[model samples]
Target: MSMDVRDLGGRPVIIGAGIAGLMTALQLAPEPVLLLSRSPLGADASSMWAQGGLAASLGDDDDPALHLSDTLAAGDGLCDAQAARRIVYAAPAAIEYLARFGVRFDRTPAGALRLGLEAAHTRRRIVHARGDGSGREVMRALIAAVGSTPTIAVIEGFEARRLAMEDGRIAGVLASGPTGPAFLATARVVLATGGIGGLFHDSTNPLGSCGQGLALAAHAGAVLADLEFIQFHPTALDGPGRPMPLISEAVRGEGAVIVDETGRRFLDGVRGAELAPRDIVARAVWKHLADGHRVFLNVRERPGPEFARQFPTIASACKKAGIDPVRDLMPIRPAQHYHMGGVAVDGSGRTSVTGLWACGEVASTGLHGANRLASNSLTEAVVCARWVAESIAGTPAHRTKPAIASDRPSPDPTTVRPLLSRALGVLRDGEALKAAARALLPPAERKDAASDPAAVGLMIAIAALRRRESRGAHYRTDFPHHAAVARRSEITLEAALAAARELAPVLEGVT
Candidate 1:
């Protein structure tokens, strides 16, 4: 049945004012936009934390076909090729759009977009600004451009609580204010809330990311896809912090190799080796670490100073961790950095929930299937958000109706954290997931954890357990083989929990 998109009133209520949110607002230029940011302007958004350059097919030697192929290969048979092609083909235009918006990407001596390399891409099409600061610069330009555009009404510090739905149609979001909760003037809602940081004990996502949008939508009955497939970068600096610091992919792209404590190159088996898909490399690093030895990354063999000069963020992080890029191999471990799956949406970024849309890390547009290729996060954000803006542009504007109270229960943190830590994060098992659900249940017949932050974490754990066969970021030790049919896994909390309990015995002895 065709959704009555007209009932939505189409003003595009966007949540989380990150780069994706900014781009979405700008793309629909001069429209009355209601941008809800959790923090003040340009504070803790994940896009500002990005270090890898933007991936595109902007070079003469590069094309979208190769970009699509690389993205698909990295996705390990789960990527929608049509979506990949469309997004890849739209790269040059996105870059041109950025250029028009005055994003000063890094230039060569003669000055053209100085494209760099990352894992999976066959060509050097990553456009950057200052070395390892493309996201920051991009945000600066986008923010300035959006601020100048008269129609946008920026309201910072109002974290979105839940989407206000009436009779199964999205009206607006009920958000919290400084004093108390208030109704956001919503016509149509767009979720660009970055990645999920609160789910993992160690993550590269900003602390502001708790997957609230995903949780709210899931609670509201939006069909989520590929919740199992969470991408862990093989090389996040394991250290003290709420969200662990990221080690950029540029290190590997610039020739850093992973070596074990015994000083043997463990990734020697894979073709493309360190540059292989993120899942393979991360697993290889995990396996090496499992042998009671820490895996270390070394760029000393290459021109160390040049590599350091090229990737200062990594160099500084390594240096702070007491490793010198010129002398020692940096101790590294695989940690959750990006989530490839989220609230399932169409090409136009419309979710199963009417009048609601999603873009950025929170929305899975079938672009990054099982695993996301490095640098595609930024590219995907621009591509998808642009589509979302355009799709909403023709949507008729209407005032959000009267607010309705939500029935979804909030979580008690004391129980859910350890439960989530045990089940989800970088490792997984079916048994652990089921146990996590049981252990996390409050004895009070609580409906609370149902909408908990850990609820989405449980969803990821359960979905990972359900797709028993090993594929991409989801490594199933019980079913150690890959499935022939690489279907996108979808589920609800109830179905996911049932599946979780069913296989609890299977994942019993595994972590």
Candidate 2:
């Protein structure tokens, strides 16, 4: 029995009540909106966990051109120049819009906006809210603004299971409420569900960001891009913990270095070195350790007091791991921090499927391209969310349609948990990834290209395999030279599945 709705109260339904989702909801024109939070509004959302400031082009020294150049350079030739320029050009206005919602940005004594720097940034243009607690602070303001709005309704702890499409258009979602799974009213569904980090064995992304949205989008036949370009942050707390704690990039901006076991600066030859793009930094570190992560440093050099001031939270987290940032270098490496690839959405955040829009980390807006520059994800979130809202509000909702009834499965947390952990973590070669993907698929349609996780894995694995040379984060030890020519690797479900099957024989050996 398929259920559908045309009037879900008043406004569109937003999934994953994070900063992007909430901000997009607010930007709608008096639209009665439904925001579903899988956990308490702020707790599980990765938007709240971002430590560095929002990247922008506000300073006199910075301009949209500079920002675009940095973004494209970091993207490793996969970034869409127009999309990058559009987002960068919109930065100041987006930041101001947030300020209107009562985001109290840090101010200097002379009443100037305070800016900070992170890796790949040529100027000090990152606008932060609190000291190293920018995400938390910004999220607090947005959540509060949403709470006060009379038209917006937020339901917490309702984990969305799957999207419900009607006649090939998005109607609503099948979500798990407090009691049971049921069909919910979704006029137009927008997935602000964040990136795929918790899918890995080790990640800085909160446990909730397990690519549930990624899998759900793929399940719903959305096109995903650059799936293999996972960003591993340079300095994660390297002590005894299941998931590593992120040491903010601000520490490096304030003069931290990446050193090896002998305190030798191993990154001396690496371009941009410690300040290099994240993928380069991550691979350099991943080289030290074979299986999962890589190793490097967050050296507490000359500007100890300044580094402490900028990254107190990071300093405190390192202290929890029995390391002192002021005295010793924080032994660190890359853990899966951000996903550069996701369900492909255009500038307006619309997917190939109609009425389905995505923003934040969930949508590959082509703003991040192959690699995201430091602190830019947050900027992209605000800019893209506004664009999504503007496009969605003016468009008329489709005529009343019956809502699709959610297929509520009996609880099986353990099944999904393990399935994601082994197969989807950092570092996948052609063979093991294929096995992992194949093992993860449902038995009936393991070969089905459309929704098979194995097929998805094959797509990503083939991209990684074909690259042959190391450029940015997609490094292949087997083929470790940067090719003279560069091209973006995009695969249709069919093409990816064919490649996966062709390479299945080769990848089988790794597993």
Candidate 3:
């Protein structure tokens, strides 16, 4: 069914109402904009659930250069140095902007912003709000600010299923809302649809985050970079839940330790132990669990009884899981937390596809190379969102009659979650990746927009299989060491599908 796109007007349309989308809308204010959220604002967003604070060089002793250095080191040789530098230099001002939006950050006795430490950082520069509720607080402030802005129109409970293209530029978005399927016409579209963690059985992201943006962009012929590099957080609270609760790295910064069932410290041999880069720490914990040793994050003694006061959110989560951080060791395991890969974008958040932009976890801006620096995801979202908005502001609007695209039902995530979890979770091998790629290929071939999760799953598996060496978060057991030279993988969805077809026979008899 085709609908006229002219009804939706020429206002810029933003998708996914998380930090990135909200920030973009606010930045473009005074210039009319339309914002879309799959769920209610502040709900089901990884931003609100994020416990760690934003990373910025706000301290006198810290500098942007130092922050850039840490980010580069964490990226494991694949980071774009210029992008890292740009984001770090913009950090302090970004924090100030958030403050203007009414975000109350933790402060010191002297009235300066209080900074906390995280892994791989040379200085204490993590700015939080209410200890572990930084993301929630930021979202609360942004959501309130968005409500008062007269130029932004928000539509909640709508899922963007496809991007409508005309003459090779984005023209409109085909979405399914409470009123049923509808198409919104716009000259520009911004995709801030979070990460691909929902494809994993155990993840710290909301189930709705199934890489819809990546799939949409791929179907629109956008180039994707480094899709295999997924960061598995080391300390998600062990439990049976769709979205597992995370024990923020801030707890470790506050003096926690990871121990085995016998209370033996398993990370003692690694330099920096619990404070090591997340990739290193997660891999260590995964090895321990794979070796039949149960792991736990013990903060009962180091941080002591004040644990509840320091991290109220994590404390609450622990209590709900029937454990007290002040007295008991909390069971922990590695779970998929963030993606370092997505539709390739530049400094201004422009994707390879014309008239489309992406920010937050949905865009690979080269800040996070093979792995993301702690607390840097939020920083990238705000910085790139502002740039994207500014870039759009200077452009003239064009009104085109909307052309309708096929509206396919979104695929059930359950069909691909288990396969992805087994093949692309914390640890991976070539055979499993090949099988996953094979299993996911059919959906991509069908051109089913509903199979977005399967499309992204195939991309991740194919990227992981191609990168034969271990680097950062992507560890291939078959290729247990880093490559002699570091390089990144970039491919279009069409090319990936072609490669998948060629490899099908080779993987048929395996397993």
Candidate 4:
């Protein structure tokens, strides 16, 4: 018996209810939006875990041009100038938009918004709420607003597995919920499915964020770019834990320092030391760890007593781990934090495939380039969400069609994680990447939603192998030198699969 696909009644359907998906749905109010969340909205989302706040030129000492310059510099030559400019210039307004939704930003004594500085920023322009609870506060406001909006119908605990296409255009999405599998028939499908952090063993992302969006888009023939550029954060709390706790960059901005076991600052030689670009800082921390030295983020000297008051979240997390930030040195290490690469989209968050749009971490909008500026992600999510909403609003919906459902078993994420972490983690070499490709590609044959992580993993490994140079977050130790020209890598799933098959001969006789 064929299960009838649930018709969304020509509504705009959004997958992954993070900051982007929620924001997009809210922006498209009165349009009857269908929003899907893998978990409850605000829970299991990177946006809700974001410690650092949104970056904006709201400070009197700052301006958009300065923000743009810092963004381009941090992007390491791949940032789209126009996109960066658009997001940066829209920062103040985006903040205002959030404020209107009842987001209570931390304010000064005079009732002015208090701004903080982060690494790579020229000015103190980061607008935070509840010190380190920016993501939580922002998400709280967005979730409340969403609940109040009658037009936005949220389906929690339902994960969108694959995008259904008809006649080379997006027809709807095939999703699996707690009940079983069902198809959602809608013309406009927006993917706000976050990043590929879950593919790594050590990541600051929820386990559910396993690059499903990337896989879904790629399977539907969307263009993916810069798959090699995974941003490993330098200060994930080093301990036995999955989805490691993050020590916000704002802690460093407040004058904390990274120190070795002997209290030696390893990043002293770097131009900005603790305040350098994340890639540089992460590499420095990684090398220190590889050298058998214990690395810790020392905040005792600076924000000692103020820690509990300013960053209640980090303070609470540290307390739970039996480490007091006011007295003990907090151990930290590099962990997979963000992906600078994802489903390629334009400024308006439109993917290569028609009727499919993307925003947030899932969509590579050429804003982050080779690396992302701290706190700029939230800004990009909001800006791009609004853009995607406006784009979808003006565009007419297409006729819904029945989607073909497949029951191919998903590749076990447990099996895929080790291969991806080994090959595509903080450091990479061609051999490990090739081996990972060999191991990951075979399982990618199961083209269902569950196999998207392996497929996305294969894409990253292959892309890393192809880009034989160190750039930004993608540091290939074998290719220690930067290429003469900086270029972005764009590939389709078909092309990556073809490349993987050609290397099959090398896989024989290897475990």
lDDT of each: 0.77, 0.72, 0.89, 0.89
State the lDDT of candidate 2 residue by residue for 52-167, as single tens digits: 87888888888988988888988887788889899998888888988888888878999778988788888888888878889988999998888788778777767776776767
Among all windows of 10 consecutive residues in model 2, the one with the lowest summed lDDT is: 443-452
- Could you give candidate 4's per-residue lDDT for residues 130-223 as a string of tens digits? 8999999999999999999998888887777778888899888888877777789888999998987778899999887888889889989999
After superposition, the stretches of candidate 1 with alpha carbons farther than 4 Å from their true spots are 1-10, 404-415, 425-427, 441-451, 497-511
For each candidate in turn, the TM-score is 0.91, 0.89, 0.96, 0.96
User: Candidate 3, which ten residues in sequence have the lowest lDDT sum?
Assistant: 1-10
**Root-mean-square deviation of candidate 1:** 5.0
C-alpha lDDT (0 to 100) for residue 315 of candidate 1: 72
> Model 3, range 54-148, lDDT digits (tens) per residue?
99998889899999999999999999999989998999899999999999999989989988888888899999999899999999999999999
Off by over 4 Å in 2: 1-7, 290-299, 403-428, 442-459, 462-469, 482-485, 491-511
Off by over 4 Å in 4: 1-5, 403-411, 447-450, 506-511
- Higher-TM-score candidate of 2 and 3: 3
lDDT of 4 at 371: 88
The sequence of per-residue lDDT tens digits that candidate 1 reaches over residues 359-458 is 9999988888888988988988988888899888877767766654343333334445566666765556767766775554332124554345756766
Clashing pairs counted in every model: 1, 13, 2, 0
